[model samples]
Target chain A: MRRIHILCVEDEPEVLEAVVRDLAPFEEVFPIEATATADEARRVVRDVILPRGELGLAICDHILPGEDGVSFMVHLHAQEATRATRKVLLTAQAGLQATIVAVNQAALSHYLAKPWNPDELVAVTRRLLTDYVLETQTNLYPFLSLLEADRLTERIRSGPLPGDE
Target chain B: MSIPIRPLDRIREALQSIPEAQSEVRDFVTGDVLLREGDNPGTISLIIRGEIELLKHAEDGDEYPLGTLRPGQLLGLLSLSSGNASFFTARAASEGTLLTMPDDRFVELLHNRIDFHQVVTPLLLGNLVDRYRRVVRLHLEVAELTRDLNAEKRQLQAAIDELEETRNRLVQQEKMATLGQLTAGIAHEINNPIASLSRAADLLHPQWHKVFGEGIERGLTPMFRQAFELGVTREPLQTEIQRQRTAELARLFPDLPRPLVRTLAQVNPESFAELRSAMQRVPESVRLSLLSQWAATFEAGVLVRNVRVAAERIGGIVGSLKSYSRQDKADEDAVDLRQGINDTLVLFGYVLKKFILVVDLPELPPVRCRPGEINQVWTNLILNACEAMGDTGTLWVCCGVRPPDQVWVRIQDSGPGVPRELREKIFESHFTTKQIACARGSGLGLGLAIARGIVEKHGGRITVSDAPEGGAIFTIFLPTGAAPD
Candidate 1:
């Protein structure tokens, strides 16, 4: 089974934990990874998650201690390995200018404000991860329980079924 | 007014008719005293040419000019009539000539020569009337001079009052500006904590339900209990370390589910090993169930931690804000400036994220000050330094006490420093380097001027110098004693 991971980048550890826990419904299949800083997130991408599997989603806080979340997303977008990673900016204080940068430069897939609705976060995650699976992964059965089941089913039906050799 | 006859010529003519036996002419130069105030000259003198000034000698012996006597004015008339010594010191005011006759001869002339008496009588009376009119003119001139002096004094007083009011307004305006900035910065600083607060609040119930309300067996499992304790204490493992631990666990428990192994690997090292050992006692089928229960309690702990941290952050900021604003404070508050500086730094928490802040604020002695006003100075200087540095730079802040007298705060930035020539003008009201190039609203530092005002109000002073590297170093020195109001 091809693994897909959800990466969370937030400087606040407690907030990071809440966000990770909120998305725990998908954790069994997705194996969510958390990092405290943009620099650490980049290191995780380079050293651990990318070599093992594809990063299906990156949910980031826009205001951070060092490099802001939008800039990191843009950097990720510019990279070949993680170019297609679905990006989301989650923050309470990101101004319109930051949003524009996230959108125009990083192709931000979603903008989630702080104190996010858990169901909405899950739904967005499932939808975007499902998109990631369809675009990047040929295998879909493993993620069927956690992802967008209807879309995955449609994708499966449109394609030739895997034959037992 | 009728011009008096050139008295020098008439006095000379009158002298010519005096008996040659009784009269003699004399010449005297400037500063020559014709008669000392108390001297008893046996000869009565008349000015034959030039003018003599009558002078009164003060008790200190300083001569004060009483009036000028032209050539026809008699030098000894008062004394000669009253049969006393000369009543005033008679000093020659210019190059002149005089006629003198013995008092007896002068008396004989007055008795025997009616023509001489006629010539002298009106001349004496006219001189008396002229002197009386001069006294009246002088009193009016003195009154007008006094009125002019009083007007000047009042004008000076009004100017001083206006200056004092302007200084006060500058302080108030800067305070309003500081409050504006303070509210903005405080709002931004409060957001992250607020987010944590709301999110933690939302998660609290769900986490509680999962731990105690769900299926009884799962919640009661020994594995769940240990995981709950471990989660309550442990910080999240870094991704890199988790990866290493996960690789090792995957090798040791090749038969176990990969996801379960990954979850187990994320606990602290001791707990990870202990849980792995405990899991060895459980059947593979039940281990996944136990892991689920364990992860729930861990999450509850993390949420509890989040709420705790968020509340603490909010509380700290409020305390700092209270100290920083010091609202409704009408009198000088004795405070350690370092405390206010710390509070100001707290308010600037969000903005300071972009800089490498090095703060060395040691404990300082308390000084009498308006705490809120002093805080404004710190905010302005720190912000101005940040603005000068733009997006990112190093900031060095330190405090010092010059023992028993004064204390100082120094804030330095790593930005393009003020040009040497403009340094003096930078603190002037409305002074900005960008005035010619940028719009008035975008101009850089109204705060510096306000900062200067607040400092000066405390009887303290603020100055900016170039940092060792190219940047501004602003230092504020404050008196430890009572500052003048």
Candidate 2:
């Protein structure tokens, strides 16, 4: 069975660690993966995460060593495999123009600035991941505790999880 | 008081005996067209009064007013002499008088009769001289107008170029300000957290050793210390390298938990032999029992040291940024050029990450300067070098104080350089060999020109030459005495 994974792409290992730690609550159901640069992130997506599962969400820093986060997200949006993966831009330096490009071209799901509140980061991750699972996944029980439980529970009560057409 | 000014008296006396000529003149109104261009004027008519306007009709059907003709001017004599057709249209500018005579007989009188010739020749010569002088004056006026227009056009273009340069400076100024301000803001925001994080690590390290024998084995203290130190210092390995290491470690300790083996792979060896010998004491059954506690201690060290190192990195960046961007500093302040250069390097960390910067700035006397502007000069030259190198190459930056009152800085890059012929042309404003990098067009083209402007303003001279490393070398020399007012 393919699992859903959360991908965190940030050049700073310290920031990546902090972000991964915040996403610890969902790690049981949504495995977390980390990479430092766009090149490494793509490799991880292709070789590690995608081979084992679907990428549920991607939280990327706006600036990296090469191939900026917005352009990388735009590339992901262009591809069929990752088009529906939820995206969040985590940056301290993305200007208005870059943010607009992320929004217009990459369909960025959220924006989290530097020195982010851990709880808020977790909440945003939960919402995006829950949104991803509800739209694409049929199994709701695995995410009942870590995700937006009310919405998932309500969804479960309202109808059965949709099966293949 | 006659409405028609009679023809010149000489012309009347001469024509009195001429059979084919009319001595009586005709009076005409302002609206009369004396003769259309290209028409045959059968008689020579003199402008006897008021004025006549000479018009050259254009193909566009618009008449170009050449000039006006006054009384005593011969209208058709020149045309008759040349051919028989009028070359230009002559219209009555104001009410005037005219006279007519047969063209051939008028020519015969002027040629055959000496008295008539003497009388009419002066009038003809006088008119000819006046028309010649007018044409010469018109040419001079046209030439003067053209010269004036060209001078104004050059001035206008110069003004536009100056405006573009001024705008570039302002944008550069704004960019520096924003970078400075952003750095300050980041420092303000992160300083406390960083301070507290480092302090917390400092507080925890000692406290952990106190709980020594409770959960931790006192005999295993050396091994624990080594593991903690290893975690604090080791850099994360590449994925491929880490995987190989993990596989090797698993082969060595086949019975150890996979998690413990993986963790050992990360601590990469200053004391791997010691760890292996120490691990020999633990029975294979209890090794799994010790894994969780050992892993916890190792992780604590890594996380704590990561915070400490990251905190130090943040402090360095903030300090560099503050030094680089104190735009409010007075122009008279004396500063170490090296400090500014280092700060600029810090600010350019993103672009210069892959660059190998060989800085040889030694101790030198403080030079009076605008620190921000001086750093901008550094930024421009460095950026130029970076662009020349196409983002990856070695850059050499150094400064020296001459024994006299001069200080100099040299920036060199290891990239394809400016050709010898183009060295001088590169200093010129708007002279660029690069394609514009962005829409705002900042930094790519205007850099060197503005850099020269700033250096010149500081009473400095800048020059470029070929570097020994097959790249370009830019040198700036400045007065060490005082900042230029």
Candidate 3:
């Protein structure tokens, strides 16, 4: 029965308002927090707001002002701490390239899209939170340390690095 | 002009005696590699019996069948003009005989001797012209066949893409439906709590009233006690509290009747001055009740609105989907090219809204056409024009009546013109300038070809040429008066 803190980042104001209003009725839910700029978002994630174990999850906008959601998540993944929170990148741009990169690189949970139904938003959040809580409750560790040495080999074959040949 | 000449039989006998001319007499066996394509530089083969097949070598070293050489036909004459190495391999087919004559001897026989040149040079030139025309015709025929194949490929791909789009749309729809059902269930689940909240608000309204009335009664009784102690009447203060409570309660519960009017006037009449002091707090109590009721009402309103919207939205969405999913089943009849173009352009209104569309369609009689297919053609062309413009640019469509009774339509866009290298094969299968991800879409190179096929089927032709304004121009000419009225 613990409250989950969600950080949402988006560009458009109307869509943000709709999301806030839709989720307002949940008394158990805190005021849905949002940010516009990816830089501000990164700062929120690192230094000011989230810190270590403050924020539970993040739903980021794929297309943003400076750094897109994928690149931003890459930065988050690089951080030593506070990288374990579940991440979902919401996008309107079709195709799975950005989604795949963001998910695989950052070990993200799922992707959601714009004009999405409110129920879907809740369901995705619930599922993601459940996984996070399960891992934490059971004291399970999930990391990609074993695959780091073989990164270059995989990149030459399939990763997004240039000079693939 | 007067000269003595040998008889035809003597000339034939003399020519037959030569070794080079002897092959004109026998049948060549199968698998006989008669003459390597470049073996004799300008040797001509005269087929006397059986057949000789001409084969051009494909880049993969495979021999591609060209045309066959029949009896009494001469081959290799084209080599005279094309001194470059022969581009094909020649094989003796089915026991055929070919007389291979040296280039120099054949030239001499036709030029040096006046009688020989007069009799033979004209025949050679005539044969050369015929061969030239045949090659030209073959090239055109091959081009047409290629165009047909490209069109078929595009249509097949379009059907596949449409099916995929439908599948995706259906999946999205199903997800939406499931979401809607879940929403309804949630709304129903939450409704009970909202009703309980309203009931609690109702029960607290009466208790809140007593608290205000009792407080006013105590305060007023004290004031009266003090007044009596000082020997003064308390009627003025008592009347004041009664008036204040009525106005405050009306304002607090705007939707409901004033609570003080019913409670103070009918139920409690003891110590009117004391009751007035207690009624002062009645306004604040009623305000609290109103706030609780408002919250409960707001929640119920949202639940009902959300479910209603989900149901209504699903119907509108399914309607749009039904229209988009029907392939090859669109209504067909005589359609105005202009109207069809406009209708097709509707799908790309977002694209056109950013650009200036200049249409110069000459007013003319409507043409009998396949409405849906023609609409697709116009849609593809217009969409292409919009894409070429990228974010913003100009698009021009010119239509008029061409000579010999044909309707001509041309669409032009101000984008980087088609590259010269790509112009020839732009209508070829799977050819596209769009990135594979955003390729519009699965079969882009096929659009023009499909358009060309539909136009041609209706006895028309479609062509692409450089636009006057330095962009690509697509021209469609449809034969007028369908099937002779």
Candidate 4:
């Protein structure tokens, strides 16, 4: 069974650390990764995470140093490997046009502004990850407790698990 | 006044009856000068066929056409009657025939023939009356023309005054706009850092007490002390490795809280393993308490760093602002054009997020100039380029020193290029390509005009042309030597 992962890309170190700390509760069930740049995030996606894990969610800040987060998210959406990764734009300065592109082209699922509420962020993450896992992953036991338990229970009872005879 | 034959026609008939008068008739083409001012021609010529021009010469030798003489009109009459030199020059304005009667014959005909006196008296009196009427008409025409010219001059002067007032108002408006931009930029720059500093300060107090309060009450072992210190020095984690390490820590400490596991992942791997080994020796509660302390200390360090970094950024922004406005420097200084460009870019850093900026600046010699004014030149060009490109295009700014004591800066963008016909007109004052809303609100049109003014004041030239990579390119050339005041 492939592990599901949540990724965060933020340029500011303090912000990145705060986001990672907020999402620490999901560390056991779904691994969470944080990178400070879009380039580093791309390398981690390509070289390390994709081999053993499916990227379930990506919460990205729009303003970054070299290549901005919107372009990176669009790139991710284009690739088959990470195409289904649920995208969220977490930014303070993404203008109207950039936000529109993120929504239309990058398939952005949510927009969380800066100074976000920790509980809301965790809830959104849980819901997105649950939606992704339910659609793709065959083994839903690990995520059952962290996600919407009632919904997972219904899915489990409605159909046999994949590879079951 | 009511003679059956006109007086001048009657005189011509009498003169033609004389046999000797036939020999006096002569034909002239156009432009023939029959009489010159100040010359005593000693003859009075009658225009028998076409027209002649009576011209008055000025002191400066310029000719003013007094009036025209048609057939039956006489020329040289003024000098002949006055017995002085002619005051008007007569020229054949078209193909014409004239009968010239010598002054002696003219006088003899008057003295010899009784009938001639009858014709001559009225002829002379009629000519005098005609001259007086022409002079009166000329005076009226001159008065009318002078009145019209005075009215036109007043209208022109009023227009010039209105234009001057408009120019002054625009200058004030532009200054206010620049001031507003600077204030907004400074406020934005200061706002971010202050927010970060406040947030960090707020978080530090509660977290700081949590770490030491729990650890001291629970009792800190020597190994716990060492682990806490080691954790404080831990390097920040790379994304991929941190993921692997978190999972590894979770597996080893299965009963540990997830936060502890995550915090432990940020620690040095060698120290983390030693801390884990030491943790096995302690009771579970004690171990958890010690790990919690480590996490708190680690967070405190991050908060402190954030505060320091934010403060430093604020300071940097203030420094850029000071340099950009030349607040602390003299009005004229030896300036690096590259620095001015960079500082202007810093002021626009917030707006430049949507643009891919390419800066190519080689080392340039210092130019003596008013640094603040030069910075305004850069600001206008860069802002215009950004506005032109809108969002998501490349902006190129290049600067270099040209030979013969001149430096040049070129700002170009990848957007719809300026139309060829509008290139010259764009620099005109109050001219703009943007829609009315943006132009009116932002003082949009005055930017390029002011830029041109500053450049010209510095003994330089600015020009616009098509960029090589398809957009508008504005280039400014300034003298490297001292700029004139």
Query: In model 4, what are the clashing residue pairs, if there are any?
Result: none
DockQ numbers for every candidate?
Answer: 0.16, 0.09, 0.04, 0.16
2 or 3: which has the higher lDDT?
2
Candidate 3's residue-wise lDDT over B141-219, tens digit each?
Answer: 9999999999999999999977765564455346445644554565556556555655554454444445445654324
lDDT of all predictions: 0.78, 0.79, 0.57, 0.78
| Candidate 1: residue pairs that collide | none
List RMSD in Å for every model shown: 17.9, 7.9, 19.1, 14.4
Question: Which of the numbered candidates is closest to the native, going by highest lDDT?
Answer: 2
Which residue ranges in model 4 land beyond 4 Å of their true spot?
A80-83, A137-141, A150-165, B1-262, B268-289, B318-343, B350-374, B383-450, B458-485
Whose TM-score is higher: candidate 2's or candidate 3's? 2
How well is each residue in B149-250 modelled by candidate 4, as lDDT tens digits? 999999999898678657854674466457647866776778677777766655754555465555554355444445544543445666667778888887
Q: Could you tell me how far off, in angstroms, the CA of residue B418 lies in candidate 4 after the best superposition?
A: 10
State in Å the error of residue B341, model 4. 4.5
Better of 2 and 3 by DockQ: 2
True contacts kept of each: 0.24, 0.03, 0.00, 0.24
DockQ, structure candidate 4: 0.16
**Candidate 3 residue pairs in backbone clash:** B28-B95, B28-B96, B216-B277, B216-B278, B217-B274, B217-B278
Per-residue lDDT over B308-400 for candidate 1, one digit per residue giving the tens place of the 0 to 100 score:
667778867877876777653558877888888999899887778768899998888788898877887898788778777766799999999
**What is the C-alpha lDDT profile of model 2 across B1-485, one tens digit per residue?**
41333348656656666655554577889979988999988778776677989999999999999888888887787678788678799899899787667787788777788876766777777787888999899999999999999999999999998888888788878888887788788888888887898898777776666655355553777567666767677676664465567678878767765545556677767566766666678886776566556666776777877878887887888888788877654456777888999988888876665567798988877878888889888988988887788635888999997657879999999999889999878887778777664312253467788789889988899999997669999999988884433
What would the C-alpha RMSD of candidate 2 be, to one decimal place? Answer: 7.9
Model 1 score (lDDT): 0.78
Q: How far in Å is the alpha carbon of A117 misplaced in model 3?
A: 8.4
